[model samples]
Target: MASIFSRIVAGEIPSYKVAEDDRHYAFLDISPVAAGHTLVIPKREVDYIFDLSDEEYADLQLFAKKVAGAIKKAVPCKRVGVAVMGLEVPHAHIHLVPINREADMNFFGEHLSMQPEEMASMAASIAAAME
Candidate 1:
């Protein structure tokens, strides 16, 4: 069975897309920790981060770095925090979170339940801010 990330990559699931290249896809997280929070994933679905090939891992980070920069510009934050807690989804992914403080990246804390329209608007803002 395809994981949810795979489904999103395949267009079986809809996402508030932020950016994408031939190698990777980025989209807004429905349960975002902050307004500009985004998830970056490889187009090829691998179950674990370490399971990815060397080039795949490198590309993922490079792709995320670009997205994080965009998040920083789009959202009011001290810095963009990167996290690779791969337990939530079966596919390899990275969380690029906007943080004004150290606590902003705390995944265990209460998350904001943003509406879809709000997510779309946030994604548009982030995409425009990408370097």
Candidate 2:
């Protein structure tokens, strides 16, 4: 069975996509730690981020850098924080969270609840910033 992230890449699942390339995808986290908390993942499924090839890892980071910049521009935050906690889902991914403080990136804390319209608008703003 495909991981949920793969399902999203395949269009079997809906996502608030912010950016994409031939090999990577960026989307808003449904249970976000912050307003613009986004997840960046490889189109190819890999259980661990470190398990990816050197080239794959490099490319993923570069793609993520672009997404992070967009998030910073679209969201009101001092900086965009990066985190890697692969246990939540099988797919290897990076979390690009908009944070004004260190605590803003807390994964174990209560997640922000966002309405569908809010999510869509945020995604659109980030996607536009990517251009």
Candidate 3:
């Protein structure tokens, strides 16, 4: 069965996309710890990050850097933190979170609630900044 991330990549599940390349995909995290929280993942659907090949891992990281920059530009933050907690979903993914404090990146922190329109607007802003 396809993981949810794969489903999103395949267009079976809707996502507020931030950026994507031929080998990777990035989109907003609906249950975000902070505004502009995004998830970056390989399109190949590996179960773990280390399971990716050397080249694929490098490419995914590079792709994530681009998306992180865009998220920073579109959202106010002290820095964009990276986290890889590959347990929530079966697929490998990086969490790019905008933070002003360490707690802002806490995996157990309270998540923000945003309206669909707000998420869509934020996604557009981040996507534009990626250019």
- Which one is best on lDDT? 2
- Window of ten residues with lowest summed lDDT in model 1: 80-89
TM-scores, each model vs. reference: 0.96, 0.99, 0.98
lDDT of 2 by residue, 1-131 (tens): 89999999999999999999999999999999999999999999999999999999999999999999999999999999999886968999999999999999888899999999999999999999999
| Model 2: ten consecutive residues of lowest lDDT | 83-92
Task: Give the deviation of candidate 2 from the true structure as CA RMSD.
Answer: 0.5
Runs of candidate 2 with Cα error greater than 4 angstroms are none
Candidate 3 — what's its lDDT? 0.94
lDDT of 3 at 35: 88
**Where does candidate 1 stray beyond 4 Å?**
none
* CA displacement after TM-score superposition, residue 19 of candidate 2 (Å): 0.3
Which candidate model has the greater lDDT, 2 or 3? 2
Best by TM-score: 2
For each candidate, the alpha-carbon lDDT, in order, equals 0.90, 0.97, 0.94
Sort every candidate by lDDT, greatest first.
Answer: 2, 3, 1
Instruction: Estimate, for each residue in 1-131, the C-alpha lDDT of model 3 and write its tens digit.
Output: 99999999999999999998899999999899898999999999899999999999999999999999999999999899999995879999999999998889877867899999999999999999999
